[model samples]
Target: MEHRRLGDSGLAVSEIAYGNWLTHADGAACVAAALDAGVTTFHTAAAWAEGAAEEALGAALAGARRDDLVLCTGVFWPEGAGPNAAGLSRKHLRASLHGSLRRLGTDHVDVYQLLRFDYRTPLDETFLALSDLVRQGKVLYVGTAEWTADQLAQASAAARRFDVPLIANQPHYSMLWRVAEAQVMPVCAREGIGQFASVALAQGVLTGKYRPGHVPPGSRAAAGGEARRSVWPLLMPDLLDRVGLLRGVADDAGLTMAQLALAWALQHDTVASVITGASTPAQVVENAKASGISLDLDVLTRIDQLLGSFVQTDPRLTWSPPATG
Candidate 1:
């Protein structure tokens, strides 16, 4: 897999990062496949399965040399009933990192991300706390996820003031979702923050497995619960029909629909990596092929023409949940 520098930092990560958000049932096999495929980055979060995901990823990587991997995790979701169980306060950040380290069996995460903007916590407290983590050698770099442009500016300023190594932002960027391109990307580009794009396949929608009016058995949409809910909006008949047309584009380019989708997202220079999820080893190997494959300009134009009106580009659509009371 090709590796690129994360933002302006000297650290380089794989073009495709294996993320175990909702698909960690066969973590060991998938992780092994990713490693075999040359993927050096693995992303997980404390909120994913209430920290079980980290434990699974940690166990899966037990034999690999730690220095050879770029391990990333996120915080800011409530891990307990207490009011302080979440957010970016010093106490919570410290507690969360310690818990994450324990579960992940790691001394320090290569990148520790703030899963969301903490509305209640002062930015000063949050940045200061993060800076301390870096100083203590528990975190190598810091990042944010799903934060708005204004929030990114604020955080960038605070990061500078505290001398924090704020180098990346994890955003939900995909073929169907272009919200970040409107505002977040510009701000991050100026601030020297690269994007680790999540859901590059739109939760498997862009894989072209879901037909115009049919939800295949054993599909994420058919499984129900959170997976279904996450993909339901993109399952509209018109969108699915339009997505079906991309098969020709993929065929013409000698790429799978998934590969075309991933290549589209990686076209941007500001995107450091595309965080992909896999339930099986084959999927990991397939995604790794998209790393160095560059889509032609004509193919990009064709995609825009096909999904023009359906694309979600409203900057206001980028949002974060309010702090819990």
Candidate 2:
């Protein structure tokens, strides 16, 4: 797999990172496939499956050389019923890190991220807490996911003041979602933060499996609840029709629609990795192939022309939930 330095950090990560979000149940087989396919970075979160994902991944990677893998996990989600169960508060961050380490069977995570900006917590408190983890050798690097440009600027300044190594940001970036490109990317580019683009496949919409009127059996959309809710909006008939037209572009480029979509996300210089999740080993192997593939300028132009007006580019679309504290 091709490796790139995460932002200005010296840590190198596989261009394709395997994340266990909705697919944690398949962690053993999928993690095996990813490792075999030369994938070194594995991402998970304490909130995923209520920490089961971390346990499964830790078990899956038990025998692998620790030095050769890059394990990433996140905080800032409600993990319990207590008032301190969520947010980036120092107490919760420390408690969360210890729990994550115990579950992942690792002493320290390569990258520890804030799943969202906690409006209730002081930014300084959050950064100081993260910096403490670094000092304690529990976390090597700190990052954020789904944070807006202004939040990133504030965090960037705090990171410098606290001397924390804030090296990455996870954003829901994809061909159909270009909100990050407008503001987040520029801020991150200036702040020396690389992006681990999630939802690069638009929750499987860009894969062309969800047709205009049909949702494939055993698909994420078919499995109702959170999966269905997350992908439902992207299942618009018009959007699916536009996604269907991209098959020709993928065919012409000798790539699967998924690969085309993933490669498109990797095309950005600010994107250090495209975080992909898989329910099967085959899916893991297939996504690994997009690691080093490069789309030509013409292919990119064709994608834009084909997906024109269907794309969501409002910077305001980047958001986080209000603090209920």
Candidate 3:
């Protein structure tokens, strides 16, 4: 697998990071497939399956050297009934990191991220807590997910003051969703922060399995749960129609729709890694191949022309928490 520097940090992560968001049940076999494919980074969240994700990941990676993997987990999701159990406050951050470490059976994670920006917490408090973790050798680098341009600037400033490593920002990025280009990319490019792009397959829509009139049984959207809600906006007939045209593009290039979409996302310089999910080990192998295929100018232009108006490039579409409660 190809490797790139994560933001301005000295660390290098696999271009394709194996993520466990909805695939917690896939367990060690799925993770082993990624490892065999040369995926050194494994990303999960404490909130994923209520920490079962971390436990499974820990068991899977037990045989590998700790220093060889980039293990990442998140903070900020409500872990309990306590008022301080969720936000970026020092208490929650400290408690969460310790719990994550214990669950993962590791001393330190390569990257510890905030699941989302906590508008209710002061930036200084969050940054300082992260700084303390870094000093204590619990978290090597800090990152945030779905932060706006303004929040990134403030985070960089805070990291500077705290003397901590603020390395990456994770966001949902796909051929169908280009919101990051206008809202997060420019600032990240300028500030030396890399993007850990999630939803590279648009929650499986970009896989071309969802047709205009047909919703495949057992598909993400058809499941009628969190995945459905997450991908609800992109479920329109117009978008699916445009997606169908990409089948020709994929056929011409001898690639699957999933590979085509994944390759498209990795083309950007600001993207450090394209995190992908798989329900099976074979699926992991298929997704990993996208890293080797580069979409030349011609194919990219063809994609743009095919999906022209269907692409959502508006900066405002990039979601951020409200500045105040």
Candidate order by decreasing lDDT: 2, 1, 3
lDDT of 2 by residue, 148-183 (tens): 999999999999999899999999999999999999
- TM-score, candidate 1, is 0.98
Q: How many residue pairs clash in each candidate?
A: 0, 0, 0
Q: List the residue pairs that clash in candidate 1.
A: none
Whole-model lDDT per candidate = 0.92, 0.93, 0.87
Error of 1 at 16 (Å): 0.4
Stretches off by above 4 angstroms in model 1 are: none
User: TM-score of every model?
Assistant: 0.98, 0.98, 0.96
- Give the per-residue lDDT digits (tens) of candidate 1, residues 303-324: 9999889999998988889666
lDDT of 2 at 317: 93
Q: For model 3, how does the per-residue alpha-carbon lDDT over 127-190 read when each residue is reduced to its tens digit?
A: 9989989999999998889888888999999999999888899988988788889868889988
Candidate 3 colliding pairs, count = 0
